[model samples]
Target: MALTLTCERQGGNYGPACAFSEILALAERRWHEWFSQAPAMGGPYRDQYYYAWWVLANNLVAPFGQLRHEALVPSKKQYIGVWNW
Candidate 1:
């Protein structure tokens, strides 16, 4: 829905090639074993099936934090949840 449109509106999509690169990096980084900071998500043979859905999150773009990229931009408004997505 919004993602399909948002990708288009952002000048252009990240592209299949770039996207594949990201996937490969995810594999090389062993995200299948440990995807996030949550210890529950980490394991020796974590199925990681549900982890795929994490991409649907606005987790990448932000002054807010998620996963590895942690940074905060001060502002009066508050982002309580994924509502910003």
Candidate 2:
């Protein structure tokens, strides 16, 4: 996933092989976790889509540009959801 994001930024060059870095591994873990917890909003993975955007915004886009995109605030749906929030 990390490799895909960077390669996309580079316009599909896919130059170097992605190293098995800890951060990349963590990102993958979080992605899976988000999918697992998606049932909180709806069973068809509706909530997961929001979190995927959150991951791109918070973890990838903002950090890459070194600018504040927005606060990493969880929406009310998260904490108040029926599933594990």
Model number with the top TM-score: 2
The TM-scores, one per candidate, come to 0.21, 0.28
In model 1, which residue pairs have backbone atoms overlapping below 3 Å?
none
1-85: candidate 2 lDDT, tens digit per residue:
3534342335546566556585488678877785666444657776677767665445332334444453343444454322221
Q: Total clashes, candidate 1?
A: 0
Model 2 per-residue lDDT at 32: 78
lDDT per residue for candidate 1 within 3-48, as digits (tens), equals 3221222544555444656656766565554445445544654556
Question: Candidate 2: which stretches are off by over 4 Å?
Answer: 1-24, 40-60, 63-66, 70-85
Q: Which stretches of candidate 1 lie over 4 Å from their true place?
A: 1-30, 33-36, 41-58, 62-85
lDDT of each: 0.44, 0.52
Task: List all candidate RMSDs to the true structure.
Answer: 9.9, 11.1
Candidate 1 — worst ten consecutive residues by lDDT sum?
3-12
Candidate 2: clashing pairs of residues? none
lDDT of 2 at 2: 50
